[model samples]
Structures are given as C-alpha cells and as structure tokens.
Target: MDTNQAGPAAEEALARQEQETITQAIAKELGISVKQVRTTVGLLDEGNTIPFIARYRKEMTGELDENVLRDIEERLSYLRNLGDRKKDVLRSIEEQGKLTQELQEQILKAVKLQEVEDLYRPFRQKRKTRASVAKEKGLEPLADWVMEQRRQGQPLEEAAKYIDAEKGVESAELALQGAMDIIAENIADDPTIRSWVRQYTASQGILVSEAKDAEQESVYENYYNYREPVHKMPPHRILAINRGERENVLKVGIEVTADKIHAFILRKLVKGPSPVKELLEAVTEDAYKRLIAPSVEREVRGEMTEKGETQAISIFSGNLRSLLLQPPVKGRNVLGVDPAYRTGCKLAVVDDTGKLLEVAVTYPTPPNNKKREAAAKFKELIAKYGIQLIVIGNGTGSRETEQFTAEVIAEIGDPGLAYLIVNEAGASVYSASKLAQEEFPDLDVAERSAASIARRVQDPLAELVKIDPKAIGVGQYQHDVSQKHLEESLKGVVESAVNHVGVDVNTASASLLSYVAGVNATIAKNIVKFREENGKFTTRKQLQKVPRLGAKSYEQCIGFLRIPGGDNTLDRTPIHPESYPVVDRLFRELGLDVASLGSKEVAEQLQAQDAAELAVKLDVGVPTLRDILESLQRPGRDPREELPLPIFRTDVLKIEDLVPGMEMQGTVRNVIDFGAFVDIGIKNDGLVHISQLSGSYVKHPMDVVSVGDNVTVWVLGVDLKKGRVSLTMRPPSGNDGGAK
Candidate 1:
C-alpha cells in the first residue's frame, strides 16, 4: 500500500461523510427535504448569492426565503467547523493510544461543538493536576483496586506497598489519600459521569444574584436580588443579570445540591460494590465538589449567556429589516433640519430627485431666540423650493424645531405641507465619512448631514445603506452581543431589503449598487465609472461591458438593476434578460409587442391568462413566469410602496399636552424585549409595554410590532416629571404598568 495515497483517500472519504451528515442535519432542523438542502448547498458552493437564489432560482430551492437561505449558510459553516474540530480531536486521541471504538463513534455522531468538546475532555493534556501527581507517585494500580472493590483486603495495606518517601508518599495514610485523589479525578474525567452531572445540575439548579452594593442606585437595581430557575430564566433577564455582573454591581451564582449529583455519579460508575463503599462514596463526593460541580455551573451560565445573545441578535436584525424597508416619501422637495442648541439648526433644501438646491442656518430655540427670523426664512425656503415635506432630526432641539416648522406651515396654511421627525442615529457618522465628503466636498459636515436627512426621506433604503447597519441603532444590547454575529446578521437584513426594492441602475449610488444580488464594492464603483464614461445604461446587456462584471455577475445582478426610460422597455422591469425569449414568444403569440407593456389594456389581458397554462407554454418555472407577468404590468415597481408610510405631523404636541385616553397615531421607532417606543408627535416617545401592545399575551415585542409601523395608540398615563407617556394598542382598561 502507498501510504501517501492512503492518507489522501482517507481524507476524501471523511469529507464526503461529513458533507452528507451536514446535509441531513440541516434538512432535519429546517424541516425541509434533504434534496432541497443538497441542491441549495450546490448553489451556495457555486458562489451564488442568497438574494439571487431566492428570487431567481426558486424552483431549485422550493421557494425558500432569503432568511432561510442565510440560516442554511450559517449552519453549514458551523457544521464544517465542528467537523474539522472533530478530526483534530480524533487525531490527537489516536496519537495518545487511548482512542476506543465507542469514543470514536460518540465523537463522530456529535452534532454540537460543545458535545464534541465534552467527549474529548478526558484525552486533553492536563497541567499538573492531582491525578497526574498521584500517577507520578505510582498510585494508579491502588486506585484501580479501590475502584473495583473486589479484593478482600484492606485498601490502605495495598497502598502501603507503593509508599515512597522521596516521591511524597511518606505513610500508609498518605498513600491511601493519594489513591483516593486519583480515584476522584478519574471519576470526574469520565465523559459519561460528567455529562450526567451537568444535565442534573442544570435541571435542578436555582440561579441567584445579589447586590454588590445594596445602597447603590442604578439601572440594574431590579436585578440586584433576582432569582430564577436555571431552566426557566428568560433571555432578557439573563442578559440583564449578566450585564449587572459585568459592571460589578451584582454577584451571580448557581445553587445545586452536591449530594444529589454525587449519588447520581455513584449509581452510574459503581456496580457490584463490596467493602470500600464508604471510600467510594467519599471519593465520588470529592469528584463532584472538587471538580465537576464548579465546572458544570460555569458551563450552564455560559450557555445561558449565549442563548440571551442569540435572542437579542434575532430581535435586533428583525427590527433593522423593518426599519430599512420603510416606504419612500417620493416625488417631493424636502427641507431637512439638523437641530442644535448653540450653533443653530443646519438646514438643507433638497429637490424631488434628492439634489441639494440650497442650504441655510436658523436658531429658533432658546439663547438664539431668532424665532421670527427663522420662521420667515423657513417659509421662504419652503415656498422657494416648492417643499412639500419637512424632516427634522430627532436630536437636541428637535421638538423646538418641529414646533417652529409646524407653526410656519400653519401660517402658510397648506394642509399638504407636513413635517416628520426622523431618527438621526448615524447622521453624524455618515456625514464625516469619506463617501459623504466626496458627495459634498463644499458643504460642511452638519450641512452634509442635513442633506442626508432630506434624501433619507426620498428613499430610506438608499440613504441608510450609506452608513454601517450597526450604527443605524434599531436594537437593544447590540454593543453587548457578539459584534461579528450582529454585523453578519444585520448585513443580511440590509442585503435582503436592498434586493427586495430593486434599484435604478442610472440613479443608484455605489453604496446602494454594492448590495445588489451579485454586485460588490469594486464592481459597483466600476458600474458607476462605466456609466460616467459611457453616459447612461440603455439596456441590461450594457452592464456586461463594465469591468470585472462577468457572465455570472451579469446573470445574478442584471435582474435586480432596473433602467427606467431606457431604450428597451423590458429593461425597466425585473424580468431577467435570459427570459426575454420566453416573453417575446408570449407577446408575439398574443399579437402584441413589448412596446405596448404597462398599458391598462395590456395589464388586464395579462392578468386574465391562466398562470399555470402560460408558464407551460413559455417553458419557464411558474414562479418565474408569475414574477415576469407582475413586473411587466407594473414596470419599475418598488416593494416599499406597498408598506405603510411614516406618519407625518402637521402639529407638534408636548408632554404636558398629553392626557389619558387620548387617541393618536404614532410610528414605532424601536422595539426591544420589554416594549416598543412610539413617536406620538411629542418631544419624547412613549412606551407600549409588551403586555399592553395588544389585549392578548405577547411573547416578545417583535411578535406584534416592528419598527416603522403606523399604529393608533391610546395614551394610558403620563409622568410629566420623568417626561414619559404610557400607551396601549388595546382599548384603555384604565390600567397601566409604569415604565420599568
């Protein structure tokens, strides 16, 4: 046998087995067929983007959404990592000549990385533990003798023969003690015993926390003396306690009975016992208390932390998706205000197409006291630019800015003129970015931010894409969660949102274009540069001429990149170029041309046909045909238009103006675990606790509400001192839970 060839062959076999296992595992967990998982894996391995596969290759994946595809991708990566770690563990154990058939089987069948680690713990190299020291003193045989309990002799007399003064076994008692220590360490290292102990401790443990300083007043005071069962603790409570513990404001620990765990271990490890029952019982107790108990408690706590973080990340990403998908307030000029206290509010007038036409500064708030001058200037700007909307940053002096803008609109008395306070979380960061500098070289940072605010109303997806999603700030504990995990999940949300609302190739910036199905930053820039050199992209095929945009890239991205008023009308729709032949065949059969698309008569005719029959005639998948038909009818459609638009305020309200039972329309600004904060046309947003979100039980805030939802809420109460309002979606029952 050629040894080199055998090694490569074995590796190949192992890889095949690993891939098969991962495929089956994903199929089971996701409740999909193995064939679908296998096909999806093939597509992913071929370097297809998630959005492309979701939109274009629906038949191959059985019409799974982008979220599921992302889940598959994440699970596949995790399984591959687990597989590699198992290989490393198996090799190390085999090299030490301790790998057994049962151990190998257990390692191979392990699904989670933690399970594999647990199985491998026994073989891992130790750092001079009691067992290793006893072994150095030649106490292993005595320990084995004591464990079997079969010998009809005194254990200490057997241990006395191995006593060596120089080796630290100076007496019979000392030798017996060393033997018991070895026995205890051995029991702790046994994978079966350790697993049982961990499971028992977790099920029976009570998680408790205490205040480090009882007199300290802080946000975590509620968690200072908290107690919950380890199994029933909620994710938010876990996260709160963890944060308090990290801040050194609380001491947290798990309480489990040591005796129960020791008894369990005894039943598992000891059978046909004889004279040494007392010795074995003591050894088992020592095994649990001295080693396994503390280690397992820490592992349980770590597991809880992981669960909490995962829940937080999921909620954060879900809220981000909702925030990004807000409807665009299109085809209107906007006056954007970046409110401030001292330097004056920076204002920018943006035209319908998001071009900055003018910039100004006005200080209507205190100290500046330029309300008269600012009102006149704002009125002039609104009339001069034909502004239909006003957007004020929800930062310092925002309420005053909004109040002033509303008064100016009232004076003009245009019911059509409305103002909205937009969350300006990352405006400053985006303004200082290199991309922003290039977009507005002459404008100062605050002026650029004002322009960004205006454009964000024009298209939230386009403008928000310019900033990092982490900075967009529609999340809770985002900083405390895993940065890498949060970034990856949010990136997926952004990509899904961008692809959901296809971009116009001629109008989209590099930041927007980069998130298209197959487009990247470099290629996105290349597309722009190509447009600059070549004027406008008249057709989808023109994209192929751009540098680094190959056949695969074009196939993936061309369907998502729209071209309005281009030479080819079909290019304006989302129909992929590859399907143009099928479209032409249908239209030709109907005695019509593509030029007649979007007409009311054509839309009715297309809608009247049977989708299944037409799909068969065109030799296309049913999903693809339906999409083409929809796109042809409504060319250049944006998905955001179907969603509710952000509620605008023609007048502003103050905390003092609110009263219980007052019904008002609001926009959901942020949804956290406890509740959602709603912007109710006031300076401060009000809280709608999860219990009050609806007249039913709520699992979490994300279940019933999302960011940017336009809802009708009734005020439950108000605390003028704290500047807080309590709200409920359900009819007022005259009950409220004050903000906790």
Candidate 2:
C-alpha cells in the first residue's frame, strides 16, 4: 500500500479520531466529566471567551468558575495541538516509508509533544554525519548483523565480506570501524533507550554549578559552588543558576555516573554473550559519551527552565491580581509626590475622583538642601487643596521624601493628613507612554508620574491598566521568560481581575474597559467616544447603540459593566440582562419594587426567602439566582474592600531604628517562591522567608500572604550597612517577653 495514497477522506477520519482522543484526555486530566469537557470545548470553539462562558453558560458547563474554565480551555488547546503534531509526525514518517504499526501506536499513545519528537527523531533527516557517511559507504549490512547479536562465528571474517576497495572500504579494519560508527548511532537513536535514559538521568542526576571566577563579587555568589539533585531542585534555584551560567559567572552541568547509564542500556539491548560483545560494549559507551549524554543533558536543562518559567509566571500573575484589586482609598483628596534628589520632588494633587487640581515642585534633598522651604511649600499646598492623603513614590530618595512629608504633616498639626508608600513600579513607564502624553500634554514626565502616583491610590485598576503588565515589577525573572507566553498569561489575569470586579461603563477609561469580558481596545475606545459624544449610559440597553458593539459583544460584556444610578436598577448589579425577567418576577413575588433594591425591607425579605425555593420560582439555575442575590445585597460592591487595607504611617522609621526582636507593622510588597518581601518602614524591604511565613509547613509563600497584606512582622535582624532587613511573621516565643 502506498502511504501517499491517503486521501482526504482518510485524513478527515484521522482528524476526527485525534479530536476525540484529545477530548477524552482532557476530561481525564482535568478530572471533569466528558460531557462537561465536550460542552466547554464546543463553547470555546464557537468563540466564547472564558469569562463570558464562566458567567453566562452555567447551565451548559455545570457552573465551572473562571479558573477551572480557563484551565480546561488551555489544556484543550494544548492537547489538540499535541494531537495535530502527532499526525504530522506520523505523516512525515510514513512519507519516509519507515512507519510501522508498533511505532504508530506509540506515537498515538504519547501525551507530550516532547515524547512525539523523541519517537520521530531517528527517522528525522540529518545533516552530513559519520552515521550517514558509513551508510552511504554500504557498511549498513555489517552494522545490522552486529545489532542482531547472534552467537555467530568470528566477526572479523564477517566484516571482511564488506571490505571492497572500490567503495573506499580499503581494509577489513576500516569496514569494521564504519560499522561500529553506524551501530553506535543506532544505539543512540533508539526511541525506547532515549526515553528511559532521559527519565533515569532526570530522577538520579545531580545539577552542579561552580564559579568561573570565585574571587569576583557578583549577585550569584551564593550559587558559586552549588549542587542539588535534579529532581529536588527548586524552580528559583534552577532559574538563578541558569542566569548565572548565562552571565558567565558560573559553569553548570548535570552530573550522572556513566556506569548507571551503561548498565541500563546494556540490560535493554544486550541479549547474550556473542563474539562481537566487546565491540558492542565499546560502541555503547562511545554512543553515551559522544551522542546521548549531551543531548539528554540539554533536554533536562530545558525542562527545568520551562518549569521555572511557568512557576515564575504564576507568581507574577497572582501578585498582579492582588495588586490590581487593592481597594481604592475612596473619597480622599490625595497629594502625589514623585521623589528625587538633584531634581526637585514633583507633586500633583488630585481630588477624590482622580482629577488633577494642582502641580508643584520643591527641592528637598542633596545639593539644594531646601528641606525647610520644601516642607513649608508642601504644607501650604496641603492646606490650599485640603489634602487628606499623601502618596509618596517608593523610588529614589523615597526615605528622605517620606521623612519630609511626615515632618510637614506634623508641623501643620493636621491629624487628618496621613501618608502611604505606593509601589510606583510602572509609574515612569506610564508617564512616558503615549496615553500619558495625550492625557497631560502640558505636564512633564515627572509631573505626570506624580499624577499617576496619586491616581493609583484612588483607583489602582483604572491607572494600572494604562501601563504594560510586564513593566510592573511583581514577578521574579519576568524579563527572562518567554515574553509572548508571559504577556498572554498576564493579559488573562487582568481580564479575570477586571471581570471579577465589574467596571463602571459610564466613567471607566478606555484602558479599564478594554479588559472587560468581550471589549477589545477598539470597542473600548468607541464606548468612551460614545459617552463623550452622547451622554452617560443610562441603561445596559444603550450599549446596543454603540457602533461596532453588536449583540454578541453586548451579551458578553454587559454583565461585566455596571451603570450606577441607571434607569434600570439591575444595570448596576451583576445579574445578566437575560436574567432581568427572573429578577423582576422574584421582586413581584416578594412584594418589592425594583427601585427598592438594597433597601432594609427588601434585604430582610431576601434573607428570609429560601434560596432553593426562590431558584425554582424564578426558573433559573441556583448559581445564577445566588449571584443575583449577592449582587442585590451590595450593588456595585468592590470585592477588594473585604481584604486588608494598606498601612498608613504618620511617622517614619529609618533602617537604623530597627533592632532584633522589635516588632512593626508592614505591608507585603511582593510575594515570591522563597519568601515575601514586606515594607517595614525602611530604605529596603524585609524578607520573611518561607520557613518564617507560618508555624507549620507551607507549600508556597503566596499561600500565606499576598501583595497587599498588612502583616505584623518582628525584626529578626537588620544589616544597616547592606540595607537589608530580615523579618519573621511567626510570633516570638513566650520566653522573649511575649513579643509580637
């Protein structure tokens, strides 16, 4: 049968089989029913977004939340892609006339793309090599005879048969050498052997790294002489060693004994004692040293890197979500300060609504030495604008600026004036952006940064959306990972956060609205334009009139967008428009008007009604009814308010003031794999290592704290010269004067 004769019909049938295989695999891997997997896949295939399907298609998907739905969608795509790659591999091998039933079955059973590639490697065409050259010289027959490993007569005489001078096989020795080369290549290329070797080495190998120049000081000093088991090495250590190796500060490799690999290969391939056993033994050792070990080492390192990148991206995603969802310091006039030394501090005061009311500059540190004058000027501006909160950017000269602000507030004798230290990671990025330029054409970069600093405290989600997620310094080694993958994951995180906390359609900036369930950048801009041209959206129905926002887009996005004080009261809540009739019926049954939502009487009635009975009465799923009831309880409530608030300080603490056993309040600035970095009112943030995160075992530091958690940490140690602070969240022992 000609493999080329596989027609479209056959191809289509194969594709259908492949898709079914992928569906079954996903269902088992995700621990969900096959029906749920199939329905979710169909929804995704039909262009339904994760947020939309999670929120609206509860009846079809069994109420899978956003995270589960996203996991299923991601795994579905990966498995389908894996299946496609398998087909391509099969076709390529068949085209080469090397496809066997056993090989095909192995390829079909493979789950990972790496496994498929390993299976296809031997048949893959190669550049000019010793193996190819030997085969070209017609020595392959001898190699095959050697691979047979039968108790044959003398192998030298057998090699003599292939020794033809005309074909460049000048002597029996030359022919034997070429055959040995071919045999070694065959041993190295065997898929089964490679798989076992890879797995064994990964489990038993030790990753060793040593300093290239031990005397030189570098950030990788701790890793200069590091050795850890490959299977037990943590992701951060792997990434750090990789970075060190790439920077030429260290040499890294996986160390495994040749004896172990040798025994494994011989056990699998060697059948019995033969005349050519010694030759085969030498060939196997040569294959491992020259061909197999290097390849397997590369594979193991790549796997480690990929795993590290995945963990780093997950940490970044979680931290970004927590940071973006930090509760807004509502209804406070904030004065933002972009601190600097040679250049004066840039200040911008914004109203409770994030409207810029004032901008000023004062030299507070170094060369200028105008502390008194700066304090007097800031106090005057605070009095003039009635500033209730002062946000200082945690950047250059931040400590000095914070101290100055505290002194000025105390001098003014205004107990209402408090200060907070904002992360300000991407403020400069946002300030120099085109969006910032259009927003404040007249202000300089520093002034714009001050405005952003102020707006972040007022509304983090709205302001953070204007900057790229990558620029925000939340994750470790974000710049070293795959940018495309990182960006995709971060974008999903932003979307999840935005949809989780509904947006205000009337007042949301294009940046914020762009992250809604179905609204893209173009549509978000159009929505803002519509609002600017027409009036505020009075009802969710008005979204239909927005050009380019069609029915499908409205259905996907309307549930995530809120219109406070709109003509329809349901517009402000999370209840989908399709469920409005159900809510109306419930309202009538409860003898409450739609306008009386969130009223005391209505709240009482809702509390008294049985949710199960109410769900049946409304003819909606219990999930939808429960969500509606939650929305009614608090219309347009921000979920972030339920979490801890940012720590505010009326006085400043320098690094010199810290001592062992001193306890202080701080906010979690960043969470990483090894520990959490907390701001303890100093020049540098303190590290609460994973061991110190809790009294018991913790799988991850993020499980204990988040980016905005206000925790009480005791100072374990402080290095004033190095500007390092070590902290512990675990309460002190009773013997230590009951220190917190």
Candidate 3:
C-alpha cells in the first residue's frame, strides 16, 4: 500500500498550482481582463461588500454585475477555506517530523481536501488502538519482516520464527497474527481506499428502506414505499425520510453493492505474488469489515446533511422573501378572526395603528346551527367599529369563514370592506409562546391568534418578525437544516427587510425593534422601555439616553427608525441622524426649509432639475446629493409599497377542475433547481418545469420567476388520478400578452 510515500510539502505545492489554474479558468469564463480579476480577488480577500464595491469602485471592476461579483466572492471563500485546511495539515505533519522526500512529493501532488487528509492519516494523532499497542511492544521489525514475506512469496510461519517472547511476541502464530493486524490497519488507513469508496458510494448508492419491527402509523407514508438514488433524491423527500426514521416507523439503509467495490480495491492493492496476494485479500476483507463500511456510512450521512442544509437554506430564503413582501393593508380598521369548529371563533378588532379596541367570540362554522345569528353578530361588530378590512386566519375552517364573511358583506352591500386571508402559519406558535402570554395575559390563546392575524394585516413585516422564521411555513424542508445557521440567515433576512422599509419608531413593537440593524434584544427592550418612560421620542438625539444604545448602535440603526413628529424635520426621513448636517447643508444651498423638501411633489420637481448643479452647489457627489434630495422629498415612504400587489382571484379551480389550455391566475409558490411550482388553487401545486419557464433557454429556474411572484399560467396537462397538474407560463393561441 506504499503508506510511507505521500506527505505535506507535496500537497502544498499541488494546492497552490490548482488555485492558480482555477483562477485562470474563472477569468476566462467571466470574459474579464486578468488584472481586473486579480484586483477584485484581492479586494474580496480584504472582506468588502459586493454592493459597495459594485457601486463605488466601478473603475476597478469594469462594472461587474452583482451575479458575477457574488460568484467571485463565493468561489474565493471556498479557495480560502481549502488553503487554510492545507496549512493545518502541513503544520500537523511537520510537528510529527516525518518530512521524507517521497512522502513530500506525493502530498504536493494531491488535488483535493479528502486526498490530503488521507495522506496525513498515518502520522495523524489517534486514540489508543491495537496497532499502536503492537508498535509500542517493539514488534515493528517482526511486522516489517512479515510484510516483506508477503512481497517475496515466503511462508508466514517462517517469517514469524525470529520473534522474541519477552517483547510481546510470544509465538510464531501470534507474531504472524499481530503483523497481519498491523498490515490491515495500515491498508485501511490508506487514502486511496477511502477516496475510492467515497466516490463509488456517492455515485451509486441508494437510500432503501423497510418497515420497522413494531407497527406504527405516520404522516410520512410515501417514504416507506420509496427508494431513491442518493444523487437524485429531492430535498423534501430526504427530510421526510429522515423524519420517518426519527419516529422509528422505518429502518433506513444506504445500500452500496459490495462485490463491485471489493473487485475494484483488490485490483488496485493485490497485484504482487501469492503471499502478497493473500495478505492483500486479508486486508481488503478487513477494510470492508473494520473501515470501509463505517466510512461509507459516515460519508453518506454527511452528504445527506449537506444536501438537507442547502435545501433548508433555500426554503428559508424563499419564506423570508415572501414574508417581507406580504402586502401592507393600511388605513383601515381591521377585524381579525381565528376560526374554529369545536370551539367558537376568536375575534379582535384593531384600529389603523393596530391597537386592540375589542375582542369577542362567535360560532360561524360547522356544528353550529346559529349561522344567521353569527352573520348578525359579524355585521354589528363591523358597523359598530366602522371596520373596512376583514383579516381571517387561514387555519381550520378558513374557507367556510371566508364564505361567511362574503355573505355578510353581500347583505351590507359595501364593496369597501374586503377580506384578506392572512397566513397564520406561525401565529399559533406565537400564541402559545411565553412572549405572547407576557404581552396579553388576560387574552386566551385563541384571542392572541386573532390579534396576530390583525397585526399582520396592519404590517406584515412587523408582526411576522415576532415568530421564528422556520415556523412561518412557506419553506419546503426547513426542519432538516442546522437550526443555528437557519436562525442566523433568517434573522439577516428579517433585518434587511426591516431596514429596507423604514419602521415607525413610535408605533414599532419591541419584536419589530429587535430586527433593526445593530439593535439586539437588550437594546430593543431598552428602546421600548425609554419610550414608555419618556413618552414618544420628540427628536433623534433623545435616543442616546436609552440604556446601552451607544454611538455605534445609533449610527447603524437610526436611519431606519422613523419618528413621525420629531423636532428636526429630517428625523422623519430615511436620512441617518449623523447625516442631518448634510441635509442642513442641502437645505441651506436650496434656500428651503427641511419641511418644504418632505413632499412628494417637491421631490419630483427637484429630480426634474439638474442634479449635478445641486451636487456642485452642495459640495457632494451627484449620486449622494440626488439620493438625499429624493429621501427628503418623500419622507417615511416604504420601498415595498412600490412593488405590485399580490393578485387574488374571485374564484378558484381545483386540480380536478383544471382542463388543458385553461387559463388561471396563480402565485408562484416555489422556484427550485428544476422548476417553479405555482399554487393555482390546487392541493398539489402545478409544475412549470424549467423548459416551460420561458421562451428562451435558461440554465436555472430563477432566471424567470421567484417565490411570491404572481403570473398567469395555462393548464398544459392534468392527471387527476395521479394528482398532478402540469402548467406552462406561455400564452395560448396568438395572445402575446398574458392572462390574469
């Protein structure tokens, strides 16, 4: 097995060579000058933001788009991690002082992380083992003699005869056995064998299953009858299988056919004479029993974990995007209803600012014969409160409640009062949580749920941020990922959303405050506490008095905190508190008060004029001054509101109702590697495969559509028995414009 041949210096040289080759490859693919690539790489190594670099250093990058810049950033991270691992391996090997010429050459020639680690394994620190004990007893010479016999076609017994008893070599048979054990251990530790096994398993293994020994019923029935190739298994299926395994409803195994691997390894390691052949066979058998099986299992598990994490991250990103984009139902008194069957529906009425004004209960669903009375009660509540919007929880009996609300609205004949089905995925989780109990001790759990639905309608971002991201149910496989990574990533998404759409400081909840950039839980609480003690913040400077809110935190967070009626006119704008002086300079240059600039009509007038003239007069960059002038012109504007509203249909069709060439209005539910799934009022979301996503060829589904986006789709095919609906984004006949 040539165990003593590969080492660290060789590996370092190989990695450096590979890195240069990859860099050249990337430069060629990106169609950029080599110098530009190098400069971008260097800047990326220094930890610069892509947006900052793209916007501010266009001369250096030659105006690289965000996609190319992000690609470079991700690739650079991988290469840097690889380089760090190489260095660690080299240091560990050098400390062992096993710097042989042959070993150095082999290590330097290795190309992958797995190969480098394999070469370093023999010298790597390990726990107490049989081989280490044999080496400690001074049996290395005898072991080496036996190994030589395997090469020379000598009998094992003859090779074992020269062993001395006192040094732990008691008999010829025992000596030969000890030597064979060492040989097996060394062969098993060989990097080549482990690498080969990993490749074979990844390419060919299947996750197969059988029923558990005990009878059990589970939600994951599909996995019990399923088998999928490891490389092709979808993320959701993997999560389902894992969840089933955790529940002990199935016994899962990663199946790798053994004969093929055995033959491959035998051909690689057993090419010498008869004794050597026998020893190689023994080692191969031992490798499978002692090393190969366990290693293959670990590798499969790790692959599954990686796949699961990627899927989970995708799901989280999609959910966060949807939550952030949820439409803000503004300027209306909203009545939220959490409907139930056994228990009556819990209702809460909140005004435009989302302060709870009333709470009640009613039976409006099945198992209740008082339907007419329930209708009367709903009309009385809406008329009494002058409610303009009805937010209903899309939980149990949601459709029936929707029908009930529609009937009541029909009788009132008021088209102004419309109903929206608010997603209540995490509302239940929040209602049962400690925070909910703390905030509304007098309210029952059902009432809390109603309040959440109402608050979401008032401002989706603010209320959705209160619940854990994973609990927000827009994901496909959230439970399969690392919880800590998922939490951090989703938190970033929430913070980005909150910062993107500036929050009203006086009206923001502590939960919403926590998502502001640079504001931790403690600072958020302190801000709320200060608000309670000192009334509304009259000026931005008053924030400094809040405990633990230092200058740095204030600088990062103040721009996003909107004070509706502050002393300084710029305090209500998105301009940072530190940038107040810049706004003052602009005001002085324009011969205008800050209040005069805070009107949309005035902002449009400023934008129509020459921005460069304003910049030169104010002594700032044209871009910076233009941005400031725009912000001042339309104070407290929400960026999200500029995007189009989500379209809902007056009528919905089921999967069974879908016919070929039928047009339907649907919202894209998920965009994946292969396709986009649209929820066209069907239990099973219809698939618009990548081939059908656009008229032009696209390498990825994201090129056309993203989650939460609404589009018109044609029903291309339907298999009702199979519960599958195939859809296409292409318009039917000669209609170039889409249907909605």
Tell me which residue pairs clash in candidate 3.
Answer: 5-103, 7-103, 10-107, 10-108, 11-107, 11-108
Residue-level lDDT tens digits of model 2 in 462-540: 8999999999999999988889989999999999999988999999999999999889999999999999999999999
Model 1 residue runs over 4 Å out of place are 1-14, 272-275, 732-740
lDDT of 1 at 388: 94
Q: Which residue runs does candidate 3 get wrong by more than 4 Å? A: 1-120, 124-130, 133-139, 146-153, 162-174, 204-229, 244-275, 584-593, 598-601, 608-626, 647-662, 668-703, 714-728, 734-740
Tally clashes: model 1: 0
Q: How do the candidates rank by lDDT, highest first?
A: 2, 1, 3
Estimate the lDDT of model 1: 0.88
Better of 2 and 3 by lDDT: 2
Clashes by residue pair, model 1: none
Writing each residue's lDDT as its tens digit, candidate 3 over 527-555 gives 99999988999888898899999876776
The total of clashing pairs for model 2 equals 0
**C-alpha local distance difference test of each model:** 0.88, 0.89, 0.74
Error of 2 at 371 (Å): 1.9
Error of model 2, residue 134, in angstroms: 1.0
The better-scoring model by lDDT among 1 and 2 is 2
lDDT of 3: 0.74
